[model samples]
Target: MSAVLISVAELQELLDTAGSRVRLLDVRWLLGDPDGPQHYLDGHIPGAVFVDLETELADPPSAAKGRHPLPDLAHLQKCARSWGVSDGDTVVAYDANGGMAAARAWWLLRWGGVADVRILDGGLPAWEKAGGKIVSGEEPDPEPGTVVLTPGHMPTVDADGAGGWQGLLLDARAGERYRGEVEPIDPRAGHIPGAVSAPTAENLTDTGHFKPIEELRARFAGLGSGPVAVYCGSGVTAAHQIAALATVGIDATLYPGSWSQWSNDPKRPAATGTEPA
Candidate 1:
């Protein structure tokens, strides 16, 4: 299998090479920013198509479905085709902040059965630092593609599955969030019982790139050895955790509903404090 991560220089070479047919998706989004389009217009990689995370990548949010419900497979297929994806073509996704947002596309495409999807390591800054040029405004519409999207390429756990998971269940939120000290967005603060506190931020270095493979392997090693599943405030950052686990040869499942869905329910148990419970 192709690596889930790709470097800036490697991407540049692929884009420069003739007949490479790599699709570049510029997914510029902030949690509360309504200006994703403006961010893309300010500057983006040349020949890159901008994708709307809210509308394209996820379905309408409901308290019951979590903040970022997975998009319907048919809708995602249409969106992927609109972005000019094709069968046998490589897809690369990137965002301004590390690979946080872009990891959504990487995981979605891989889950949807795109064989060769990757995230631009270090994201936009890495591209700039590598001497890759940026282009303002959008490029012309790309030729529609015929890539078929098939789900089940990746593993996932629902709320019930998470609660009773026999293996490792990782909570990819911050310590404060997991401890119920702060509940910024979700209905409730705490985390699902039996889930370990493994914040997604630690997956990256200060430079915003993922840590070395050996380091990542060692980091997860201390967490325990078993089938792994990861969740976050919503489902978004959990994908980042899954990508990091992939780099270390560990296959982790995603909890799409995550805490957003889990907390909304009064029946399900919530655990707070430093311990995993």
Candidate 2:
């Protein structure tokens, strides 16, 4: 019952009692395997709709904007309605890749002004393990939603803002990437200067559910006391970091351009190695 996460049992209750008001989004995506729609077609929650992170969730990429810039607000509104979301609907997003990808939908919907959005804790694996029903093939799209959306509901920072940020800037990429051990898809390796490495994978337990609240609190203790901003390779898993911080009662801003945009700009200095120098 975390503010940003919903348990499988809680989702089941809502489905049983408030079915008409619940909007389920299956946001299945993985870094190398991004064929989300086809994977969703193979199996999904009974009423969940698929959200494509590449197309629906993000704008087309460019050097200045990073790999997954926030979708334009108007486009996001259109997409939300297509998912059958209404102003007051309870939106739940889940993915097979822990909550890594689904958290993007959760963050976007909230930023677009949908209140009460939650990530299904442990995602699909949790659902099935709890004996929750699963169905294959696309469910008929729900009636087009009437949800009205506004941008900037959640905090965000652009490259310049991230560069000058005085708060704790958390780099939510893998430690190896943060250390510049691999370049992968970006123009360079290494993390934003002065940002701390807090990989999103550590947020989960072996069972894939988020760890207990106290444990999370202890994990982040003393990282910083000021405002927090987070970023990952392309701003996707960063949402997962924000979600984890949320469960720990920390409000964080998202750096949408993240490392992708930062690395591409030759003007921006890339700092490698362990120290956040």
Residue range 1-277, candidate 1, lDDT tens digits: 2299999878887888933489999998878888989988999998889999899999999889899999999999999999999999989999988799999999999999999999999999899888889889879999999999899999998999999999999999999999999999998889899899999999999878999999899999999878999999889999999999999899999999899999999999999998888
In order, candidate lDDTs are 0.91, 0.91
Show the colliding residue pairs in model 1: none
Worst 10 residues of 1 by lDDT: 12-21
Q: What is the TM-score of each candidate against the true structure?
A: 0.98, 0.98
Clashes of 1: 0
**Tens digit per residue, CA lDDT, model 2, 19-94:** 9999999999998995788888888999999988899999999998999999998898998999999989999999
